[model samples]
Target: MNERSLVFFVIVLLCAGFMALSSFEMVQDYIKPASGRSVILNHLMKLTVALVFFVVFLYTDHRMLFSRPVIVGGYVLSIALLVVVLILPGGETRTHRWMNLGYFSFQPSELVKIYTILFLAWYVEKNQLFMKRLFRGFLKPLLLVSPFLFLILVEPDFSTFALLFLTVMLTLYVAETRGVYVLTFFSIALIFFVYTYRMGMLNNILRSYQIERLVSYLKGNVSEQVMRAVEAIRSGGTVGKGMVLGEEKLFVPVVTSDFILAIVGEELGYIGLGVILFSFYGLVHSLVKVVSRMQPIPSVKTFISGFAILIMLQVMVNVGVVSGIFPVTGVTLPLVSYGGSSLLATMIGFGIVGNMILESERE
Candidate 1:
């Protein structure tokens, strides 16, 4: 692996360690709603799955993903799962984001995120010459990505949708698609949004809670959950309440998952938050540095850019939500969140990234 990638790997492990320790602290306090062996086993499973994926992708030939059939099949399979996930019960009707596997739930959206990145990178690299064309280049890829996106939005996963949008947009931008096409595309999207609202499509599509969150954000008020997050952050002051000493940890709902950043802020204070943010920043910075320093193929450079942006965007979204900067999103803090699917997906992303560097070194 390249020097930059190796440094990032170390940072990822450190972040994972910090998250694991913090999660255990929550477990001891009984902050999570679930109980018994499930929680413990689930945590163990994330680590186990992460190890397996990272090892395979890191050591093995990364070229498997470049196979067009593999890319197309993976994309199709992920989309199919997204469709199936929607069919599964969410709470009242069917599940939105995950498929229950008895012992633990599997989030197909997580897998889709990685696949989307790979698909765009592969598609862009192959269609580089034709990319500047309007329909053949821009519109076709948009159409291809839209079905998966539509399914995700139908699942009402706004956060994941946001990530997907960024990944595709960054990929196109890196591919040097024309500014006019990008602008026209956004303009058309705005028109589509208006049409959807006019036809009551947006209303039917967006969930009640999602609408509430959006309204709440516009009005500068948030749900009680974020209120608790604000309180937790305030209580931590600077140096933190000292890990397990954080009395406020239990109050914030989903403190072990979505709002875990608040836990870090409250338990370890700004110092801990600094470490978390710094680690993410360093990784993103290193990826950017790698892209700048190393002369890789255009596709590889775009892959690095898109991948780094995905990490940076997710981190910002999660941190921004917990800190009350952005509207609430289901985005997790990557390796720092106690989520098996998210953790595994993140590992897959990094492992592929490392493999890209490995291939470059061989070249």
Candidate 2:
């Protein structure tokens, strides 16, 4: 690997370390309340999943994913998984979002996001010439991506769906697809939005909790969890209360998952927050530079760029929600959150970028 690639990898590690540190103290009950195993195991499991996926991606050729069979099957698998979640029993959670496979609970929506990136990248590359043709190239790609987005939205995972939509759109834009195609998608999206609002279809589709969250955001009314997070940042002042000393651990909701950044801010203070955010941007920046410098196929470049955009948007939304500027998106801080699905998806996504860099350097 090149020096720049190494730097980006190191920055990823630094961010991951901080995430682990912040999440180490989460109540064991959150994962498996009755397991009787040490709570530390939960965090370790997340780390293990992340590292395994990253290493696997580093060894794999990203180009193989574009094979006709893989693309077709992968897209079908994502749709099937999304549908299966709804079929399974939701029970107390009341959200049909996960597939309980005895030992591991799988969140298909998260993995599908990664798949969507690869699909779009491949599509853009394959159809670069056909983009000007509205039906064959432009509309086809949009039609293919719609199933993934629709399933996710119906899962009531509006946050993840929103981020996914933005990333795909950005990827299409970068892929040099016709501007009119992108504009058409946006126009249809706006019309759909207005129609849903007018017909009450949006409310019918979204879960009650989601509606409440959006309402709170629109009204400028902060939730108790956000208020506690604000207090944590406020009390930290310039320096901080010190690592592992953030008192917000007692009150803030899901400190290890959704609101991990708030703990970083409280424990590491503004300077630490700056460092974390800077590392995030730096990592994404490194991806951009590596992808740009590499003499790769257009799809590869677009894939890496789209992945970076997704991570950046997730970080912004997570921080914004915690800081009271945006609604609770349930989007985790890229490498700085404590969910296996999110962490695994992030590591694999970045690993593919590394793979591209390796190929470029080899050439």
Candidate 3:
């Protein structure tokens, strides 16, 4: 398997997602009159734009893009976007998670994830010899990334922050940072978590609904949304009820974004879900093979590996939430999710990876 094969799987997943969303849109039509512009149409437009980004990144040289000055600028821009989202008005879900642009809303946290990985790849490569040291290898990198994590946490996006932090640590580990240092940082993070819990800071940080979701999950009590999702999936059985025919998806909250898999299960059945999972597996497998072959190019290898980890982490959390195994974390299902920010960021990451693959092949 190669980059082409990896991208082919992505397209398959994308098409599957579109079919699910189209089915959802058809379901919605039964209850309401057709609006001038529908969500599916808007999503299509965003998908078109996202494809442009993917192509641009695929053709562009990643080395030029990840140069010290360019990566630094992008890192600074990402931080500024994160800060702006917090300070600006008209955020989503009463949280500072989205920056409302005049035309459309943007999720700064998503962009920050990409830039953080890119910046880290550059930083790690520059300090490869010092990666095993406490300061240069671990502490400095952690400190540098702390602001991004802290700002995201303040946005009260605990899920994204947690996952992003984990991804960063994984990147550092892959870059040969001291394992003990990473472990020590985890210990400190754990202690901080305990302190925050004891101080009731968690409540202050997370919204009431978010806390409720977490508590419900911890107590083995699934929320109505998850319940509906599970029911929808189970009803699909071996083969789905049929495309656009499943009624249960209508009851699942955020069906097009978070619980889209439930729709896949309900409409296309186990086969569709299996194909989606297999495509994702293929994507990660291809990425791992690419990383292994890029041993001579440590920076590219690390960045791609980190990106792969991010995708897998989101997939697990999203699937777990839908299946009642984890709390609702508002994580999108990569290419399948309906969010423009996630789609654009993911496409850009893939394009960069594709470029790296071509470059490596040329060598």
lDDT of 1: 0.77
lDDT of 2 at 222: 92
In order of lDDT, best first, we have: 3, 1, 2
Per-residue lDDT tens digits for candidate 2, residues 1-363, read 344754665566446555545444543244434546443466577767777888888878877777889999998898999999878887563677888876667788888989999998888788778766777566787788998888888776888888888888777777776777888788888799778766767677788788778777878899998998788777777787776565565577887778776677777688777777777767777777777677858788878888878888887888888888998777887766767777778778877877777877787
Q: How accurate is candidate 2 locally (lDDT)?
A: 0.76
Error of 2 at 104 (Å): 3.2
Which lDDT tens digits does candidate 1 get at residues 180-287? 888777788779877875676766878877767876886899778888988887898899876566667677888778887677777778887787777777788778
lDDT of all predictions, in order shown?
Answer: 0.77, 0.76, 0.88
Q: Which portions of model 2 show Cα errors greater than 4 Å?
A: 1-39, 91-93
Residue 239 in model 2: lDDT: 81
User: TM-scores of all models?
Assistant: 0.90, 0.90, 0.96
Give a tens-digit lDDT track for model 3, residues 153-174.
Answer: 8887999999999999888998
- Model 3 CA lDDT for position 360: 84
